[model samples]
Target: MFFRSSKINEFRLWGLLFTLAGMGLMILGTSGIVFWGQAGKIFAGIFMVIGMIAMLISVGVYFWAGMMSTSATMLTCPECSRQTKMLGKTDRCMYCKTILTLDPGQATQHPADTTQT
Candidate 1:
């Protein structure tokens, strides 16, 4: 669960970083020709293409994250007693640090005991 949350947070951060970088590149590319010479134009074209690709990839990542978020199961944390969501074979309560596992045979398993309350 800790790993999953970390991964999700990392993905979110990367997506944001890529988005900002792409926007900056786009602005630089468009302004370069006005400030510099023909060399600027060449660099601008290259930067624009790379920036557009980065932006597109970020959009794809956002969509993928949305899908995963929807598929995750909701639960209440036993430790924190707060509503949270879980995903995959193992997960953590979003509101608490409790390690949650859906597998019944595992020693660390927490039952899918709670419904909405």
Candidate 2:
């Protein structure tokens, strides 16, 4: 419950974060010369290499997520009446964040259907 995002969305979010981090690292590397003069070139090269590795990782993540999304089940959300993708037996609506499940055994009662005295 701590993370309520859909599986595909979570992967995309991580990929985006890695991409931004890689760009930031590359920028920082180029700016190293401004801070350390001649010796900063070495630091710049190291940072740039690390940034490239991060960018590669981000690309891999995006590709993996894309493949998974294509195989995921597409269904209409009962609460929001919107088409959403599900990664597993249970998932949440992308737009409305409503909890959904495909298992009939678990559908006897919904979390949102509690009655109070």
TM-score of each: 0.71, 0.87
Q: Write the per-residue lDDT of candidate 1 for residues 1-117, one digit (tens) a residue.
A: 224453354456678878998999989898888888887899899889989998988888777767777777777777888877676766666655577766777646555867888
Number of the top-ranking candidate, with TM-score as the measure: 2
Candidates' lDDT values, in order? 0.74, 0.89
Assess candidate 1 and give its lDDT.
0.74
Model 2, 1-117: lDDT tens per residue?
446878788899889989999999999998998999999999999999999999999999999999999999999998889999998888788888888889977775755756787
How far residue 69's Cα lies from its native spot in candidate 1, in Å, is 1.2
Positional deviation of residue 45's Cα in model 2 after best superposition, in angstroms: 0.7
Which ranges in model 2 have alpha carbons more than 4 Å from their true place?
Answer: 108-117
**In model 1, which runs have C-alpha deviations exceeding 4 angstroms?**
1-8, 28-31, 107-117
